[model samples]
Target: MPHLNLTRALTAGVLTLVASQALAHGDVAPQAVDTTGLPAIEGDWLTENPYRAEKVGEETWQRAIEIGASGYNQNCARCHGLEVVSGGLAPDLRFLEAEEYGDEWYVERFREGYTQNGITKMPAFGELLGQEAAWAIRTYIEARPDEGALDDFAEELKAMRDQMEGYIADASGADTEALKTRLTEISAQIETASGAPVADSVAYRAANLIDGSAEAFKSASEVLTIGLSAAH
Candidate 1:
């Protein structure tokens, strides 16, 4: 698989998506999202996402995040903002609650879209993208870490990223397991703005990239570089 090239932990000023904006997303053309590897949704649109960890276990849940990130970047990023961080142009979707109510609200907009006074600000995505892509995108939107989620650890993380670079050059003394464990622990501590179980932050991505190889360290280091750089 090609690299996901996660654009994460952005120091966004606002939300994952907006609720009601006259010029929000209604005008943009909906893009087709590739939902391959994701479990399909059946029997009409779902009121809740089936990709949550508890519903389909961690493996599928993680896949949903991956696929959703791609789908979101392709389809929703224009109005929703890159990395789900609204730049005051649209409502931040990160705060959208992650329960039945939020799910219903998101599905409604995603399916039917929003418009006002004869102008189409958001287009209906139900027919084109299907319920699977809808929920996959939702999975990603809700998993965004709260704004400033990485501020506390930014410098420390930068140091680790630099250390990982050294490991790439000389893999002799690298304690790869310890690095993964530390990153995992940091990932667990981060909180999502939407109250989802996981934040899918840079730490989480970095930890998953480690495999005791130079290439793995290089990839993980790049993930940190992009994520940390965006935080500021």
Candidate 2:
């Protein structure tokens, strides 16, 4: 009788544990995100986001953000929290700025996910959902308001301006027209905005120019990289 009772108790315990695990994750299957009507991203996967307003136009970016918000709610909100807010279970994604610095980590995690003690903490979403959905979700997360984002933007703008000036001064035969135009536009936008919360349009434009220019100007790119890490 004693051995029989112990066996029954162990079976009940296993059932309880299974129930709790199911409740924790809600659904084990990956939620589908509708990426219909979004621009196609070529190749297997992009290391960086290609949905910035500057890269794909404001209209397309708006569409991406809408799809991304819905996708995030369905897939990421359970662990990452609604609107990119974290409730201590996962890292707050709002702090992941919309740049290469954040992109590297986000892409890696989304593709491979995390595991501990042979248990899967985050299941890999790359195979189930393609790059378009991933980039769209990233766009939405980056759009969320963060505490220090504006201050970081201001500092970065100043550094980019200074770097552009240096680049102009040291130019030999490179076509600096595009770089000069971008720098001028960014400086004017920064000067016009006079508060902590910079306007979204201004911020987006500045970030686009800074990111786009990084390929041509190595020094400025380094500064932007360093600035992004510091901001995070």
- Report lDDT (CA) for all predictions: 0.82, 0.61
lDDT, candidate 2, 30-97, per-residue tens = 78899997998878778888887778887788788789989899889986777565555555666554
Top model number, lDDT: 1
Spell out the clash pairs found in candidate 2.
Answer: none
Residue 225's C-alpha lDDT in candidate 2?
53
**What are the runs in model 1 whose C-alpha is more than 4 Å off?**
1-24
Measured with C-alpha atoms, the lDDT of residue 37 in candidate 2 is 76
Best by TM-score: 1
lDDT of 2 at 168: 43
Instruction: Give each model a TM-score.
Output: 0.89, 0.54
